[model samples]
Target: MLAAAAQDADREFSFNEQEFRYIADLVKTKTGIVLADHKKNMVYSRLARRLRALRLESFEAYCSFLESGDSEDEMGMFINAITTNLTRFFREPHHFDHLAEKMSEQFGNAPTASRIRIWSAGCSSGEEPYSVAMTMAESLTRLSAYNFRILATDLDTSMVANATAGRYRLRDAEGLSKARLAKWTIQDRSRNEMTIKQGLRDLITFKQLNLLHDWPMKGKFDAIFCRNVMIYFDGPTKDRLLNRFHSCLAPGGWLYIGHSETILEQRDQLIPMGKTIYRKALR
Candidate 1:
């Protein structure tokens, strides 16, 4: 009976290989994210529920609906359903430590140049950029005297919108200290939620961006925080993206990446600093 039940379950939801390939190709063309052959089950598992929720019959039908492009909202829902958003405040604290120290050193030398611009590439739900803002606010109490901006961008429009709202559950600040939390966030009396303080929110500008496409910024940034975003990309794509980042960063600017990724082969453009961070080679 158990064997028969297992067979029945397998037969109920098995995805056809052709359907998988079709979905994979469409996703890659739209987002530059490659779903490997082994991810067939993952794609089906994530999107299958969406299909049911939308009252669609099968994966093929859902594919046709997505291809038709009649409903932008449904397409967005499809993308959001498949995209993984795993992030937290103060993730990889060591990187922030490095950023704070570097900022102090830079400020000491060029005290007159008050403006500091940073871009948080692939900023998932704003935690990363908010973390940067909190660090700067704490370390630079005289920040008003200096111009500072954190441009946070993500490919996911929903994530960008959520980040722009600057609201989060209390649990999201678990890694933060009581002092930093008090300084950077305020609890909403009515909603029973915490919002990043207006000061911190003012320092950040969240936007939807696809790194594979042209950047919209007018000038280069002082530093860019692009952590844990390239693991999903192919090697050539990663290299090309890094090159673009190098071009967009000011001379001797910093690039922070995920700890697991290394650019040892691309050392000419990106000088290896300690940890996974690199500095764009000065021109």
Candidate 2:
């Protein structure tokens, strides 16, 4: 009897047609994130607050508000509410390890270029880009000789603003080593707050960018770190974004992705270098 009741409850919890269609449209129009039927509750939980904040009574009315087209600011708030930004410094260590090795190879024999350009796509709250900067600083002693720049971008404007500040809680810098913490981060003696050092801070530039939109990057990059960002995107979207990354990379340049992600198609364009790492196939 209990098992039957539980089954009935689960069936009743399913998302209705209106909600499903609304979420589907949102996924289609803004981001390539597809919300399956099973994700109905997740949609409600994430967006219910928007309705409450706007003093709307129903999801349908909220959808109408979003569609009214006068509420672009609210639309941005909706995107921010729905998007997940779970990330950390060196969240996946292997990518950084591979990146360090690649940088050495690129700069080993030849005189370092005027700048080593790197992009940290979906660099949530700046941890990943700052991690890249710290890694480069640690690896290269003659930092003045080599101009190193990291472009960190994310779709969330709030996140971009936070990344620009370069301030984080002590807990956020947990996994970072003491030496790195000392060299790259500064702690406020009075408040126990932590901020990225000016030197490391200057090495990175943070901007809000929607990957689905036209890329504004000018120069080609030697290495692009776009890890853990494609899990939300469908296969075709992933392919399109990867192709864009390919276009942005220099000849024989490297690309690193989250360990779980892989190039579903276009294998010819990017040669598999190692686990979750690919190098652009030199034409």
Candidate 3:
């Protein structure tokens, strides 16, 4: 215990309980993310880089900088640091499988083209939306027939920019099947990078969005992929966010959440369709 205490004492920046609490409150107010007591070390580890980059002496100094009301850019950096982005292509294969099933149902009998909209509500680095597009491409043969589009949104501006760029390290796509990888992406074997094909990229529009704020989307979505995002929010925030998703979904549209997240509110509106999948009940 003494050795552990000594290691902690050697940390470059002094992070006190008050500073952690202040950061927690600020993050909650701004992003609806609950930083639990357990997240203190994680928060310090992440934010310490920001402190170093900004040349701030300590967490207390960083907090004061935030409080000064001129830290908008710093706030974005802070969010990007603390927000977890642990995602890969088809992190939950089941969700993509279910999406393929739904797409088949939607276009199986239709004689004419119809508009289809899907939203990847916390799209980290574009993988989720690109995966959705790939599923659509594989499921529906005639992509040109329908007005299909995907809206990918994340709170991190840098992530949004990266998503829009549509380029990723080749290793990032190792989870994808060989056929799918070749078909959907342009591989630069020499550079060890892959750029999503223009056709799939055309189907997506990337934007920076905060789920707690007013959503600018005027139309309801047929499928909403908000996986792994609600886990950070507290119970009430999660409930409210689920309710909003319920409102934003078209009747009979699907809502996919994180494997770890459960919908406890608006049961009347969102009916369980499968594991971690909910369908908006038709009125």
Model 3 deviation from the true structure expressed as Cα RMSD, one decimal place = 1.4
Any residue pairs clashing in model 1, and if so which?
Answer: none
TM-score, cand. 2: 0.90
Over 4 Å off, model 3: 1-5
TM-score computed on alpha carbons, candidate 1: 0.91
Evaluated at residue 109, the lDDT of candidate 3 is: 62
Task: Assess each prediction's global lDDT (C-alpha) against the native.
Answer: 0.83, 0.81, 0.90
C-alpha lDDT of residue 130 in model 3:
93
lDDT over C-alpha atoms for residue 144 of model 3: 70
Task: Write model 1 residue lDDT over 85-126, tens digit each, in one string.
Answer: 888999999889988888877764456547799999999899
lDDT of 3 by residue, 13-99 (tens): 988779999999999999999999989889999999999999999888899999998998898998988898878888899999999
Candidate 2: residue 235 Cα off by (Å): 2.0
RMSD of each: 2.8, 3.3, 1.4
Candidate 1 off by > 4 Å: 1-14, 109-113, 188-192
Candidate numbers sorted by TM-score from highest down:
3, 1, 2
